[model samples]
Target: MIWPLDGASSDVVFNTWSHFSLSLNLEAASFTRYITPTKVEQKVRHLVIEWIRNEIVRHIPDAEVLVFGSTPVDMYLPSGDIDLVVQSKSLAVEGPPRSNITRIADILRSTDMALGEVRIFASAKIPILKFVSRHGKFSIDISVNVSNGVAAASIIRDFIRDIPGVKPLSLIVKCFLRSRDANEVYRGGLSSYLVVCMVIYFFQTHKGMRKSHTDPSSSLGNLLLEFLQLFGYDFNYLQSGISLRDGGKTFSRSERHWIYRPSQPRLCIEDPQNTQLDAGAGIHDIRRIQMLFIHAYDQLQAEIQRRDRSRSKALLLEGNSLLQIIMGVPLNVSATGPRWIAIDKANARKSSIGSILPCSIPQGDSIDY
Candidate 1:
């Protein structure tokens, strides 16, 4: 069962996020070395690796299991969890295995090892093996799958590792994209991959980049474009609203809008100029409402002037009030706005002045509201 620990922690200080250690010696080249695994990490990884190697030998002798990630060597797997991929040419394709939980529990019980409380679940979609440790309740996930036509793991792993500066570039871009999404909307509707792609495209055509901006991380931007074209979804819709599961519990989604648009967003780390350009674009949609209002007012004003009788003017205003109401601004404020023949709106702004009705056009439009 899921625990009710939502909002249990106190609010983190605003400065806490900004307090990352600054090392003058750090270079983009040094990022690879900076990510050295901790001691606990080393112990947990070695323990899992040894147990798996032994288990495969004992349980299914002569069967070779493909071992990679942290186990085979000190590879920097971002998941931080020890990932072991097992080849399955025969037997059953499975998710995390429940029996592996019992097997792990039995193994840990006899040994004086620090690791504890192993759990395995077999579902069709995810890793076939999962191990849980008592210390910090740390866990490692292992997936077992048959070799498809393409070994996607090797392809991605090789590309990042072999390419110069790819990992650092990717890490920087990932952090920036995630931060932008969080500040833009507390939860993100678009995937991180999509955000990365958008930023890359903005920079690729940006023209003012330094020579160092040549990492393979730009490929993610390409992947994102392909995905968007293949699956048509409005990019702007991602800014609308997002929902998240809290404390492993579900609830109906809710939204909070930013009442004011940012003049210049500091969170966008891609092309600073492009972000400013887009903000103007988002605000310019109001110009359409301007034109719609003007056209409506011109036509409505002429119609009212043609009909000298004021008694039936109110009926005409009510009939064509849709454009103003939809735009949430008064019709007289718009081009198609009504003007009262007798009401002088210019004098209405005075402290002790004219009628409450604005004098833009057809006098009857005010009654529709």
Candidate 2:
């Protein structure tokens, strides 16, 4: 819920020079003022968004769009991507929810004549389409999750923003993990790639076992088998120079077992399908990253403890509080009593938003993957 703006508010700036300046400062005593330059970046993005919507409606008309990205709160860094979500009539939402990526790709084939390399996605739930416009490499990668989970995500983001002293801790932890994992390589256990592994490992270790994202006891066998399948690497490609290969179609017994390993450049490649599995690489890759992250994670804990001399003793915390806050809010809100109302913008032909980071990679860039 955002507060409304009144024209006659006493808190107003009357500097005529500001009208001619290339940037403006938003001030609030309780918060840091975010400065945005009067530049063409946002204008360009808004135009692209329009082209995207019209292109979608050219095929399918009845769809709702919810954008979660780095734009709204002005976190759109120069390196960020244009992220978006689409619910169009061309997509089938009944079964597994139609492939948003495929539809977007098809649209790109035709729409590229106008926008050039536009990215699109289809979703039965939460479909994300992210693209980079820099260096003329604009592309869209889409994925579908729980469509109904939008509100829950918002609540989670807002909860974190209300709290203080959370942001610095998370950055410290992530940096520590990245450095430690890089240094240890094989023998150590800490890393950026292994973060998910750490969390999943945490969940399982606390319970002494792994469970599917779904029911636990209902399919224990299936879950462990799937988990093992994830870590098993594609041994088909044996470190050759530019030799073409593909990921193993089957999971073998040896892959489930870890041998001595080494850590170097992270072997992890982009998995566009978002199956959220560790694919293509070997146990060596995970172990290497894990080794480093362990050291960083430990350092993060020490730093947090240092700060927590005035902080809490919670055994664990969802330290991703600040980033989560900006990520969660689809629109902004200001407190001004009951007049605040943040309108859910309909996905029109001229308006929509997407995620800020260009993390989603191309679908098929790996030779042996």
Candidate 3:
């Protein structure tokens, strides 16, 4: 478990500025900093990724193991899982042999490998092999082929490096979604991949707005609020779908080759690499999810308004309430002696934190994935 610093000890620069400025600037900075995972967590994930890669190779000499998803993109949360794709060019083309994933799971489960809770989902659409390290520092998902995930990870990493505010803004939106209990797709909510795509699309369309904010952080905060507002109040799920490749421009169902059906998800996000697949397919309740986005928008607006009034007491409550509602308690990692906590099945919200990898894409846009 990672323990974050308490308010008294946190590196917040509030006292130096005027009350209003402090409340607006420092609070925003603190919220972002508090949610961003520490470097140690990143290091542990990297080590776990390497170990999973080696274990897969040790078992299948010809197998190719490639790390993808958030681990590669560097946007993973403290509770995130590592995503690995196992492929042998020959096996990848023909698809998994009936027992392929099982054998790999067995190899990784051997006592020498020091991995635990090895489970193989052979019947899954992608056929995943899931395992947690014996130390419980991290969990990983292994799949066959699925190079598309790797390709998407590469695209995200490049965006982080090339784009000014992509990383922080994406991270902020993701944390917001996670806080609202809307980030897990398997639970019929938004996927982290979809959230990222949404953030990227916003950035693409709102590049002009970046000039309005003085710094990257403020721009990110503003963009995040706008993102929530857009999805919550303005986006028309029934009438349109989001296309990141097309600069986040909306496409009509007919023009984009999307057939509207009652059974399909309310929102349609074209996969960046595979346009045929809908990344937001798991979103079963559009109204409920949009309500969450709106709720967050309301909370953020309240906090900003309190800051404007210079009501420190009210501001603190609203700020903390917003953070608590969104991110659970700020994990006191320093106090939690363990470097990593085992995935708790009881905590349904955080259990699937790192499970979804952003690889699926929607149609349109200038830059081809």
Candidate 4:
């Protein structure tokens, strides 16, 4: 269903694809603009960061708090959590002392800054203190001496700067995976870093894309279709592994010893910086995720065919219903700005001081397109 039927004329096929492509391009633009953080939201985030930094430094004098993950690169979604790494020379080589983490949690709970009960997972591979900021309502995950996360953020930032379509495409893909509860690594879904690597690899290895003179940014609709087709139907998960090193490469999973247990055939993606590590090793439900991509592609193709049969230029120009459906964005959602802005307005009316704070719209809302 990814391509036109054999009996379809060339002109008809071209027209159908062209119309769908244009619709997708418009949808992607509108969605990006709507989800992008406003200036006021950015200020609130800064204030939250500073408040947390001061609190941590007050208790642990030598501790230096650093921001990492999506916030620095401006690629985060509206509902994204904040990632902070606390580093100090006084801390043990293994990690911060358990007493320090517990003390930090206690201090946060006693303060007005922490919105809810602070949870500390001291036994985790990388122990972390998790809490929500009362100021911006942003979820914060704090880890000690995790330098690798900081390095990964810098690398992803460079990729976004050099690649034309990475930002928008990544945002869309993140939203898609998040809606299905398949974007959290701990929950057996791909992490944001893994998702970005997949996208970069797709751009690098696509044969038609490399040869075409047209800029990939201009043809995101077609590129999205092809991306889904490649990963959903064509990718050989059992044998092949994705790599972004040396521009991009596909290697045999067995050769690299990246293969999972025989009972579980999962996706393998080698960390560009660390050959020994497989970034996608955590994705245990990759098969279901792949099938979701296939279903989304089929749904989009069906919508295109339906429009083609109707011969409705108005439908094509108005918006892309299938794209919205796949992204879990409601057809009625405004393209002018995020839905949180309206929620903030309501919150401002209820508060004694007329102040607006950023809020997250719950994802996975049913789409009635």
Q: Is candidate 3 or candidate 4 better by lDDT?
A: 4
Off by over 4 Å in 1: 1-32, 36-48, 67-79, 88-90, 93-114, 133-138, 146-150, 172-369
Q: Which stretches of candidate 2 lie over 4 Å from their true place?
A: 1-47, 69-78, 93-100, 113-131, 134-139, 144-153, 167-290, 294-369
Write down the lDDT of every candidate, Cα atoms only: 0.33, 0.32, 0.61, 0.69
- TM-score each candidate: 0.36, 0.34, 0.77, 0.82
Q: Candidate 1: what lDDT?
A: 0.33
Error of 1 at 115 (Å): 2.4
Candidate with the larger TM-score of 2 and 3: 3
Using lDDT as the measure, the top candidate is 4
Decreasing TM-score order of the candidates: 4, 3, 1, 2
Determine which window of 10 residues in candidate 2 has minimal summed lDDT: 21-30
Candidate 3: Cα lDDT at 27: 45
Task: Quote the lDDT for 224 in model 1.
Answer: 26
Model 4, 87-170: lDDT tens digits are: 887665434557567766776787777787899999987778998777667789988777888888888888877676777777
2 or 3, which is superior by lDDT?
3
Better of 3 and 4 by TM-score: 4
